[model samples]
Target: MTASLLDRLMDLETAVSYTTPPPEGERPFTYQAGDLPILISAPHATVHQRRQREKGEEEFTGALAQLLAETTGVHTLYSCYRSMDDPNWDRVSPYKTTLQEIVQSRGIRFVLDLHGMSNRHRFGLALGTMNGRSCPHFEPLILQTVKEQFQQTSQGTAKSYEELRWNHFVLNHARFTGGVANYTVTRFAAEQLGVPALQIELCSSARVVERRPLSQWRAPFRGQPDAIHQAVILLQSLVAVLQAAI
Candidate 1:
């Protein structure tokens, strides 16, 4: 975590990817990976507290993990387990800001906003549009990658996921109910900030990268090697594509 964020946070962190806890269920602040040209974020990945919206408790978390992929190269890392207090989102949100400052200073290639949606809900990840969040070029790229990913999941052509993830939550237009609702961070980071953003909403029950069982994807469980490996792989691939386009 960056000194700037740590100074303003009441969160705790550890070497363990999932062991640390926050004073208010809010994860620690990070920004060391802030220098990376690319970013990977997970905003809806809270620790699963009982009171998701307690007076001072928000329940969503996210990250900027391009550093994990481009560790040796030029990349960054910023992930937050905000309890609905998306640091990358509205100022009204309680979480402090980090991503916006990094983008304003760094030539960020792409902003990957990672998240997970519920089957109980009607949609999958809400890959938010970059229209009002960042630059104009960010819009088409963000939309296309999400659509292509959805198409791959829906089709039998995808080999990594083992089974086709053609669940009803496939990418539809932004007009769908709460379509961009969950992706407000993406919008704010991309269009409003003039940086490209891609909101990645993975379904909690979606098939694993290796077609593994769905029981493993609950919460902070990303510590499991399988889940982390999957996240790393997809994150690396996406950054490569984003870098190429830039």
Candidate 2:
């Protein structure tokens, strides 16, 4: 199963070259429609430009989004090519525009924007809801669900809740407060589209099975299979609960 997961992620990683845009007529992102009212987005899955500066890809976030969609039947939008604009940082971009269109047309009620953070952070997962401005009605349930899911032991996962809790799980940390200082996809969907949104940032250990070969700077690192397994289960649980409640 872990090997299958790695292969699936690699397939997504190869869909577009990390340093190049898609063909002239192609979009930088791909959207998959699903049965649930939730929309999963991974805007930084590939290299992106912010204020004329380039930012590295977030490793496996795109693949994670796709995996979530496959497992839970939730709508998904993930960047597949290098971006000329930062969808998460920039106030306006084609990606955000497309997101708005998807939410409107698909009657999406909740948006879960996926992102990745460095392993140096002292958290397993950090959820940003703009300090509850976004997803106000569902915040408590979201929190409860996350805590419960991560604490439980699934069939094949090797990590116990105690082991996973070493880093911790947090909500609304000042550094990643849903980009309150800027217009993030979470903020945009919540404010402009009047849809609930949450920014779910996974620590590197949870999200990345292994860095792609194209990554240049960081020494090659592989995430524990147990951690990845737990993450997948946790996210799948969130989607299941949200779909039922929403």
Candidate 3:
């Protein structure tokens, strides 16, 4: 990765965490214009109200989306402020509405939703494509590319990239089949808007440092350079795969 890219990602990591939420009536997510037909997104980048309850931020996801946009020249939509609506879970989310408008107006063909899971989660990354229902044409390619990139980047790590192959936890799996949750951004994009979409659930070891009172608050990489480096690698792999696929 270029120093500039890493530096920019570092800056974004801080920005996403410390930035003040916009006043009510203002959109929480910011759209980064791009010429590519692919759109990168991070719906849970910050805390949000979901199903009448507050949900914790997903840690570096917004920065990851921004990094992907910078590296791959793809359109991006990321949550920059605390969400008033659960973009991924709400049935009528303004995020999705705006997504539809962008897909239609910009002729976007792919939507990649990035998320982060705590270290408590078993897998390093879990890819969701609405259980094979979303992005019928691009799911296989997306899945294959992610697997290959993981194997290449995580060869000697504690997590065995090869083992992940047999785990088969990435797409249409039990924990997050992207099925039954039609309100999810990916499901809505595929089912309603007719655009292919996928949700990538990343484990925190690669992106975050969970703090006290775990539910709705935690810090991003903060002072941890290693965490940031790993996140950068993940973003680079994702951008490489996406560019190839696109």
Go through the candidates in order and give the clash count of each: 32, 0, 0
In TM-score terms, candidate 1 sits at 0.56
Candidate 3, residues 1-112: lDDT per residue as tens digits?
Answer: 4445556665776656423567777788889998778898898888888778877788768877887787678899988888867888888888989999989999998888
Minimal lDDT window, size 10, model 3: 160-169
TM-scores, all candidates, are 0.56, 0.92, 0.81
The Cα local distance difference test for each model comes to 0.43, 0.84, 0.70
Ranking by lDDT: 2, 3, 1
**Tens-place lDDT digits, model 2, residues 1-246:** 877877776676665356678789988899999999999999998889999999988878898999889888999999988899999998989999999999999999999999988877767789999999988988899889886765564433464434555237889999788878899999999998999899998888787777777863368988766677777877888888788888
lDDT of 1 at 110: 69
TM-score of model number 2? 0.92
Model 3, residue 132: displacement in angstroms? 1.1
> How much is 184 displaced in model 3, in angstroms?
0.2
Model 1, span 118-237: residue lDDT tens: 434544344444323443565566556556655644564435343223223343335422124543556666545656666565554331221112222434422222222333344555
For this target, which candidate reaches the highest TM-score against the unseen true structure? 2
Score candidate 1 by lDDT.
0.43
Off by over 4 Å in 2: 153-167
List all candidate RMSDs to the true structure: 8.7, 2.3, 4.0
